[model samples]
Target: MFKHFYGDNITEDMAMKFRNAAVALNVQISPAQVQGYLLLRKEDPQASIDDIATITYCK
Candidate 1:
């Protein structure tokens, strides 16, 4: 399910980086927010993980 939504570039390592960034910022991420991130990525391929994270999780 994650593979289908996130695509191949978002590997475990990359996901861990995202999780780590969230932890660093004391942000809590949810599955729905992940879906939102995927959509945001589809719209803006150049969007950074931090930006996506902020948009989805930081709310």
Candidate 2:
């Protein structure tokens, strides 16, 4: 799914990072979050992966 935009770079480590961050915020990652992140990434190209992930869980 995320490989579509990030190529082959979206590995377990990255997912883990996102998951950890989400967990810390008492949030969960779901399809809706991924889709929203993709859209937000498109709208904010300058945002880092961490920033995007943070926003995803926040939403």
Candidate 3:
């Protein structure tokens, strides 16, 4: 979980860093999507930007 790893008081800059990490990982995800993934990761770390890309491409 990003919030857990990074903390709940995450800032916009921190969110951008996380999004950039996903992008650097070659995962095609928007900042908002990355934020969503971070929140979701709080519940499931296995849930990732790659999974989001897979679902997006499938759609």
**TM-score top scorer:** 1
Evaluated with lDDT, which candidate comes out highest?
1
CA lDDT, every prediction?
0.58, 0.58, 0.51
TM-score of 2: 0.48
What TM-score goes with each of the models?
A: 0.52, 0.48, 0.35
lDDT of 3 by residue, 1-59 (tens): 34455555666565565555555667555656546555555554445433544433321
Task: State, as a TM-score between 0 and 1, how close model 3 is to the true structure.
Answer: 0.35
Model 3, C-alpha of 16: deviation from truth (Å): 0.4
Worst 10 residues of 1 by lDDT: 43-52
How well is each residue in 1-59 modelled by candidate 1, as lDDT tens digits?
A: 33455667567766666556656766566777767766757644335455754654423
- In terms of lDDT, model 2 sits at 0.58
Model 2 clash pairs are none
Between candidates 2 and 3, name the one with more favorable lDDT: 2
Query: What's the true lDDT of residue 30 in model 1?
Result: 71
Worst 10-residue lDDT window, candidate 3: 50-59
Model 1, C-alpha of 15: deviation from truth (Å): 1.9
Clashes of 3: 0
